[model samples]
Target: MADPNEPVHVTTTEARAGATPGVTRYVLGVSLVLVIAIFAFLILR
Candidate 1:
């Protein structure tokens, strides 16, 4: 058993391992734009 109140430390590299901020932002932006375009198209059709 481990201590319930023990503090755990984690480095930035370990915390963000396999994470890509730029690519994630790009994908999110593109998806948002596509969704808005689709809605606009439907509304204006």
Candidate 2:
């Protein structure tokens, strides 16, 4: 178990490098789902 009170430090470049790709993929997935839902709604309506 890790200590909850420990202070963790991350550099900007490291944070961006690690997070950007995953965040981009998540955003893209959500956007694709929304677009598909909207398209289906339009077609069915």
Alpha-carbon local distance difference test for all models: 0.89, 0.88
- Cα lDDT for residue 35, model 1? 100
* C-alpha lDDT of candidate 1 relative to the true structure: 0.89
Which segments of candidate 1 are over 4 A away from where they belong?
Answer: 1-4, 19-21
lDDT tens readout by residue for model 1, 1-45: 989899878988788886655788888999999999999999999
Candidate 2 lDDT score at position 18: 52
Off by over 4 Å in 2: 1-21
Model 1 TM-score on a 0 to 1 scale: 0.69
Give residue 36's lDDT in candidate 1 (0 to 100): 100
The global Cα lDDT (0 to 1) of model 2 is 0.88
Determine the backbone clash count of candidate 2: 0
Question: Which digits, one per residue and each the tens of the lDDT, describe model 2 over residues 1-45?
Answer: 889999988999876775445688888999999999999999999
Clashing pairs in 1: none
The local lDDT score (0 to 100) that residue 5 gets in candidate 2 is 100
